[model samples]
Target chain A: MSNTLEISNLSKNYGDFQLKDVSFTLPTGYIMGLIGPNGAGKTTVIKTIMNLVMKDKGEVQLFGKDHRDFEIEAKKRIGFVYDTPNYYEHLSLKRLKNVIAPFYDRWDENIFMDLVGRFEIPLNKPLKKFSKGMAMKSSIALALSHHAEFIVMDEPTSGLDPVVRREMLDFLRNLMEDEKKSILFSSHITTDIEQVADYITFMHKGKVVFSKTKDAVREQYALVKGGNELINEATKQHFVAVRTGAYGFEGLTDDVSQTKKILSNSAIYEKATLEDIMFFNNIKTKAEG
Target chain B: MVQLILKDFRVHALLVVICLAALFAASTLYIALVLLSGNGFKTELMLYTLITILSSSAVSLLFFIQDEMFKTDAVFVSLPVSRKQLVWSKYISSIVLLLLAFTAHFFGFQLGVVINNGVGFEGAVVYEGPLLWCMLLLAVVAFKSYAFPLYFKFGMATGGMVFSVFQLLVVIAFLYSLQFETWTDQINAVVVWAEQRSLGGLFGMLLCLVVLLTSGSMPLSAQLFKNKNLGT
Candidate 1:
């Protein structure tokens, strides 16, 4: 299967913030969620892909075309939604859409109008008056109206209420039904990603901790908790991260079968959620190097 | 798309209107003062020229600020266009705005001259003999030399720094133009010098110089922008 987006060895430095060598791929028709804690270079990776931030060294290929060499052609096929509303607040939504329409050949006025109606955005009101949720809906509508096959969103639902966020995740889920559409969404909200993403790339401290399908991770990674008697240094090697409590200890292990064999009726094991995986992965990576 | 160029003008149309209105009111007041005072045509003319440059600069400044709000962020640059096209659209828009500023200034000056009742609706006396176009274009070109490269490099979020520098230079140029008699005498000598040489050659030289300076900077500005990050 062809990949919709491919990034290899990307790196960027902002004096204090550095994005170390990072790589990932999103196949067509799948949602790849980039999940991380705050300040883990998630936005930096997205920005570098859009060429919004210059990379110190790396290659980003969107649909097999280099992002820089064929920037215009490549961008024409991309629908980018920033975390913040990056639009003229003084202009009304329709007027702002008008300003954006002529840039894309595939821009559908009817589709945009449809989204406007669906989102119930005030047509005549200036964007400055919009609530954060309303502005995001408008941005997503604009992104979709361009007929782009791939959507690159940087924390699009960050500040939204839960109801709106659920609606957005559902909308994104429906978007991928076409089998030709794909989304690379970055977010700190793991539940949102866990609900829709086929693949997850967990990042911590400017480095990618793990990138795998959600199913593989969910089936493989486990959380095991027991008393201190169940813990030993030899068995500790199997755990990715360990946190000890006064009466008991809990640990994250990637191989559930191996953990089951090692702990053997002494501890309870449960499937790891994206949040558990991310939390433990961060701790593990930080402790190791 | 042309939309990128038009966005700034659309957002700040009110500010433009207000600035132009102020220009009209100030010029009218200056004319009233000159009519009553009755003894300082030379000094009055210099003051009028100074106002023209300042007001024109103000209009462009408003447009620049609004443009910065949209451009410095990742908003517009994420549009499906090359940076070259984006830079070119900005240059085209700035030139059109500069022309608008100069035209408004011309009208304000003519309004003063017509009211004065003896100057035949001419603001031509301010700069002297075909030099108005040359000087206006020169001032705009010089202003943009730093403006274009700085905005491109720093994404116009830092535009205020360069803009302040631009405003300072405009003030200095205005103060220097206070030696109006000396400039007029120099223009007279240059006109005679041109007439003595081939007249067409001097006109051609000025045109070529304007074209060279502007056209050359077009690519240079685009080149400066191409490698830089869009969101500063």
Candidate 2:
């Protein structure tokens, strides 16, 4: 599949933190989940894509065009939903929509109205009074209404309740049925990523740990559970992260088949969930530090 | 761009009405005083007109403060338009609003003369007022030119403070310049020049200066906004 976005060697520095050589691609018709902890530079990456923040070194090509060279045109095709969505909060949704509609060449009032209807948003209420979910819904409505080919959201599900998050994930899934839309969303909620993402880009402390297909991820990492005594120092090295609970021991292994041989039927190997994969990666990074 | 300007007008509709009313009240006072005393209201008109224009120009500062308060610049930057377009829209809308204020104040002065004096001011005097009005607009434009570059560099609050300081400095400089003999000569020379010139020439010169200062400021604001690391 052709890529909708391609970021190569992306980097940004902000005194105390630096995003080092991050890169990723979201293929057409796929949802790429950017999973990272708080302050992992996910928002920075999203901002860089939107050119809201300056990148020290990188190439971000959207729809095969350099983002800076064709900044306006590239942005025309981008649907950006910021984490907080702080617009002109004093303006009502209808008024804000009018304010924003003129800038986009393909802005469809009908599509915008439809999205508002789908979200059941009150058109006349200013966004300042909106609940967090409502604010996110409004931002999504704005992004989706412009016939944007690529939708990039920064931590959109971070503070949402599970029900709203599920609804959001389902809505994104429905969007992907169109086969031309692509989504790149950041979330710490692994379940949300598992529910909708075809690909995962895991980041930690301003660096991309891995970018892989979800299926490949499932096949790559295995959760091995066995007795505490079964865990040796030599065997622990094979696991990305290890936990020795009173009941038993559970650890994650990227080399699942080799680990299965090393453990030799003493431990049970199960398919690793995205949550497990993310958790283990985070633990592994912390352990190394 | 129209949408944005319209938004500004909508947001400040009440303020605009209040300002226009104040202008009328101030103009009526000046006109009534001059007509009853049988002397020109030039000094009084200059003071009141300066106050009206300054207040109107100050209202434009709310646009920046509002944008900053809500962090709406973040949303704007995320929009599918170039930063240059955004900068141009703001500059044009602000100047348009200043013009609107100038126009409203002119009408208010005219209306005030008719209402308070029941007889119009002298043909030459009333026609000559636009020259001073042009200068008022130039002052407001100069204020904006000084304020906006700082606004793009810093956020609204600091820029507002800086602009206030700029005004204070202008006042202080004027006070200091009064102590100089050359400054008194220049003031007399300007008064003589004003008496010598036609209203058209005075207005044309002030308008040209206003346009020059305002136009010059646009590129500075645009460049600052372009280089700005607008945070999300």
Candidate 3:
């Protein structure tokens, strides 16, 4: 399968914070989740891909061409939804369409009007008067109106209530059902990523702590819980991280089958969620290096 | 590009209306003062006309350039429009708006003068020659001092103060030049030379406007926006 995006050795540095060498690829017809904690440089990574922020060192290729070379035509095929709606405050939905429609060759007014109706966005009200949820929906509608192949969202679900978040995710999933589109979204809400992502890339402290297929992340890592005695030096070496408590201990491991073979009689294995894997991986990676 | 220009005008519609009204009112007031003074319309009327043209051009330039640099610029950059198209749209729109404002102010001044001083004042004074020179100087100054710096810095509030100071210095230099002993003779000599040359002054001014806009704004805007950190 062709890759929609290929990032290699991407790095950016602020005087105090730095994004170390990061590499990843999102294949076509897949949803890649950029999972990370706050200040993990998730937004920075997205911005660099969109060329909203300059990269210190690295290359980003979108659809087999360097991003800089693609220029306006390349940008036409990509949709970007920033965390904050940065549109002019005085413009209404209709006004915004008038401003944005003429630029894109594939802008579908019918699709835009449909989204406005479906999302219940008021067409006449100024955007500054929109509720947070309404503003987010409007942004999504705008993104969808353009016939873009690659959609990148930054913290799209942040500050949203459960119902609104679900609706937004459902809309995105439906869009992905066509199989010709790809999405790269960054979020701290692991459940949202867990629900739609085919691939997961976990970043922490400006580095990729772990990256794998969603099923692989679930299959490779297991939460082993048992008595404190079960957490021994030999077993610890096999596990990524261990949490000890008064009653028992739980740990994460990538080689779940191997760890199970060694500690067969002592620990009980449980399925790991993406969040659990990230937590343990972050702690373990920090501890080891 | 037309759509972008229309959108920009819509965004600043209120400011445009206010600018038009102010120009109309100022022109009427100046003409009334000139007529009611009872002395034959003096040559200073041309100076007043020059001041009005330059001031209006500066204000309009500031407003449009500021909006392009700071307020609506981020969205413009992210759109499918190329940076060149965006820059050209602003440049074209500013010139159009400036022309419209200048025409309205000019006619309004003429109407007021005609109403108060009768048809006799219509051909009594020759202001067109000076007015054209004033506009050319204003265009060059506006592009260099306002548009170019605003494009480079990407913030009107930050760049505007420096532009204002520079304009003040230019004005001070012009005033200082008038202190020379032969200033009046020099002015007459240049005017005579220009008249004999026929459209040389206007051509020189047009060339300066073109050079300032092409070499100053287009490249500055493209370069600054090409590598700018838009997320900021």
Interface DockQ per candidate: 0.59, 0.54, 0.46
Best by lDDT: 2
Instruction: List runs of model 1 lying over 4 Å from the truth.
Output: A286-289, B70-73, B120-134, B154-181, B187-215
- Which residue ranges in model 2 land beyond 4 Å of their true spot? B1-7, B10-50, B118-128, B178-216
Q: If both were scored by lDDT, which would come out higher, candidate 2 or candidate 3? A: 2
A-chain TM-score of every model? 0.96, 0.96, 0.96
For candidate 1, list the clashing residue pairs, or say none. Answer: none
- Candidate 3's displacement at residue B83, Å, is 3.3
Docking quality tier of model 3: acceptable
Report the error of model 3 at residue B50, Å. Answer: 7.7
**DockQ-best of 1 and 2:** 1
lDDT of 3 by residue, A1-289 (tens): 9988999999998877788888999999889999998888898888788777788999999988887777677688888776756557778878877767787889999999999999999998998898878888988888778888999888999989899999999998999987879999999999999999999999988999777799988898898899998777887999889989999998898898899898896788899987887788778767878
Which candidate's DockQ is highest?
A: 1
* Predicted structure 3, TM vs. truth: 0.87
What ordering of candidates by DockQ runs from best to worst? Answer: 1, 2, 3
**2 or 3: which has the higher TM-score?**
2
**CAPRI class of candidate 2:** medium
Candidate 1 falls in which docking quality class?
Answer: medium
Model 2: per-residue Cα lDDT over B155-217, one tens digit each: 787877888887888767865775664442553455457657867766777687657754677
